[model samples]
Target chain A: MEKQVAIVGYAQTGYESDVDASREILVLEAAVGALRSAGISREVIDTVVTANNDYMDGRTISNMRLVEPSGAWLKDESKVEMDGAYAVLYAMMRILSGDHDVAMVIGVSQASVFPTYVPGVMTLDPTFDRERGLLNEVSAAALQARAYMDACGVTEEQIAGISVKNLRNAALNPLALRRMPVLTVDDVMSSRMLYSPIRELNAFPPSDGACSVILASSKKAAEITDCPVWIRGVGFSHDSYLTERPLDKLGSLKQAAERAYAAAGISDAKDKIDVAEVHENFAHEELMAYEALGFCGEGKGSALLESGATKINGELPVNPSGGALAANVACAAGLARIAEAALQVRGEAGSHQVKGVKTALAHGQTGLCAQENIVFILGGE
Target chain B: MESDGLQNVDMVRIPAVPVFNWSVGNFMERFFDGLKGGKFMGVKCPDCGRVYLPPRMICERCFAKNDEWVELPPEGTVESFTLAQVKVGEDGELADLEAPVLIGMVKHEGADTCLVARIEGPDPEEASVGMRVTAVLDKSAESILDILSHYVPR
Candidate 1:
């Protein structure tokens, strides 16, 4: 919070069910692409932070094999086993601590390599939930969806509308894996039903992708790029376990957003923030996040969706990049949100770009029902 | 870098299973004992007085140790439920069920937190929030799943 940090460059691999590339290749492509985007070489980066999970990678110390590809062979390197946005937070700390001027952060996951839902099951309370084997990611989200609908009058149709919007927006993002430009809510409703109210279209498609972002201190940012997107504020919070916590709302996201807003001197998010890129693992979560981020009053996420404020061309467009629901790459999904927000701020998001001139909000989440949440406020000077 | 004809060569399935043993602790041990005796038990926190099902050693909210055990009525209200039409296989693939199964989060009368389990005795279409259900213990139990067979509509 004391030092100014900015995103100098970013890059992502094309998301797909099978990227036809090994984990190392994905990491190498993203890292090299990000360096090229920043017009800098690996020598300029003082530290490298990566995001990955051992369980998901099917190997211990999953980042061990990714060092050379990440351009961190000899440089100071570390890893955060969370979303890529969390790794960015760590890289920002390295620069803010005066120990590093520039840092490279990468997040990657190859969902095609292993079972996507198994790792989710491994995160459950081992003695009860895991042993019972009754609850998994889709079922948990389905339970949350039903609870939210019961509490907030959110219909299955409204939840399906979210998928229709994001999958349609994904049509514009060349890197997105799922693109249904003309997808209808009825189509989503008719998709293969996994659990009650959670059709296949309402859930994230597992994909293989990687994303890398270059961060620099205020002094080094201008040297890296003239159009660096400043990190105005950031906050992260983790809630209680999934079973113990209330499912109707995102309590941790609310706390994280409040802290980030206060740090950025943003009291009115709806008016000040021009664009938002949110990580919604499920359709209903976007609605829940709207309330948590104070974009709307509690239990009014469906109403906000109906008001047309969160569409790609609306007043405060959310997830113009298609979000996780479009092409979720697990660890990279959160980082992709940051990349999308930066592009939006720079007016470089291509067809999905909102007419944004100043500020943007990007969110990342981990855990079932979004128990862990991070919010970032970005701005361009 | 284009391998247009190498789709099959790209992936190899490695089937590996790693086993682990976790200690359920004193509270859960006793709760399982109660289940074996056809009783539902929970731990009551001394400070917050919040009772936790699938009993735990400490209350998360009060940050205090739970020394007292409370016996709860087998009946509870279904706070929320999902009619699962598909099951995630061991390989994490979704397979359709021959018939739908009901999973409910039931808040017992004396407990603060809800217990998640399968609900029986009601069709998927008939299952709704606020439905009352009672636990049905198995005649012979080996695992938690066996002891708490399912919750049937009351």
Candidate 2:
């Protein structure tokens, strides 16, 4: 890398079932709020990258309508129809190329307006899976959950524990929508069953929100803020389609985290990383991610959870902001994870703040059964 | 702006129905032809020997054309399954089902990959992993839905 990149500023719209505001307004608020947080003006932004999906927006080239609100008007702007974490990756590359000094990356989604689960079906293999119509995000996750359970002797009760943990964590985050500070594992198990293993409480709540982050060269980041969270390392990987790939394990997430840990010089993640914010669409995914992210060994995620190691005040906390289980803003969830990690690093994550956080990991994923994954390692020093 | 809330907001629904004519290509065309003759057809990768059901043109792992066509047996083991209590409509809206449907990932006798299909015989609670099941083909087959009815306990 020619130049180190850092996150200077970040902001997120309040996560809700319906934010009352239009998509453009949400984008504008997040974008402007991020600039304000950085103490920089819109004119200082050299490039803008957005994460949005045309199908989800129910419109084609949705970013065109967002140009003005995103402060990307007449500037070098583009969009990636993936998680906002990927957009941040693009913005980092742009700054690293020396072609841009500062970049604004925004990820926005209005899951309320559209049929949320329909888009997951649209991402399937059009020829066979679409016609069969047997799989969607939740059902597919149910299959993976079942496979993981059978392979490792993980019980549904163990998976339900994750919901109890994260939703309880959401209570501290005022911006979070699904705050269940006293949620219990039995409450999750008793929640309406969608698929056999995936009950209603086990899945992410569809949410409407936007997240924006300002990335700059190290020199520019220093000028923007005193507490710039450095992007120590980043890695992303995509696996085969859902059916062809092994369902029991998150192979791509493991590969992505390995690459990131290598780049960040993290030989022991469970010891070195202080906090983690992950995008787990389902409660089981967080457990799967625990193994994939090197927080635990294979099939040992449940044991780690039972050990209370991932609790808010534990040795290594995960998803202290409640995670996607509380408020999944579609494309923005990953970026919001990054933002939450940055907040932790800056000692600004109120209520849910962990004491003495120096290093953090943020993860984002797309596709059914987490077919694609991105990992970012952040540090305050 | 603070005055705006969920109350009295104007909402308009736009009906979207787009049509697409997909070409299933030569490999599927052959597979369908084989299905018409009461045979389960799959393509084996020349390099990796991974057999893909609903036969594809290329193998992802080996990066080579899947030129070998293999005949798969109707019987397979259930790798995993779900008792679906909801059904997604054409517009992608989810609605509760009167009775749960047992859907399984069935890996055929000779194929490496699994095909997701509805399993008919077992009660949702009775269905377990590694249970042997056989394909119940739709005799007067027209489409994939008609040609392959559902799987049943062998």
Best by lDDT: 2
Candidate 1 lDDT over residue span A1-381, tens digit each:
433999999999999897778899999999999999899999999999999999889888999988989999888999999999999999998998999999999999999888878888888888778888788888999988988888898899999989999999999999999999999998999999998989999999999999999999999997877798999999999987766777889999999999999989999999999999999999999999999999999999999999999999999999998999999998889999999999888899999989954899999999888989999999988
* Cα lDDT listed for each candidate: 0.90, 0.91
Best by DockQ: 2
Encode model 2's per-residue lDDT on B15-118: one tens digit a residue.
66666778888887887777777899999998888999868788988889999989999999988999999988755777898988899988899888888989
lDDT of model 1 at position A307? 94
lDDT by residue (B61-149, candidate 1, tens digit) is 88788899899999998888999999888778788889888999888988878888999989788998889899998958676656888
Q: What pairs collide in candidate 2? A: none
Off by over 4 Å in 1: A1-3, B4-10
Write model 2 residue lDDT over A1-381, tens digit each, in one string.
222999999999899997778999999999999999999999999999999999888789989999999999899999999999999999999998999999999999998888878889888777777778788998899888988888888999999999999999999999899999899998999999999899999999999999999999988987888888999989899998877878899999999999999999999999999999999999999999999998999999999999999999999999999999999998899999999999999999999999999999999999999999999999996
Q: Hey, what RMSD does candidate 2 come out at?
A: 1.6
Over the true interface, candidate 1 deviates by an RMSD, in Å, of 1.5
How does residue A348 of candidate 2 score in lDDT? 95
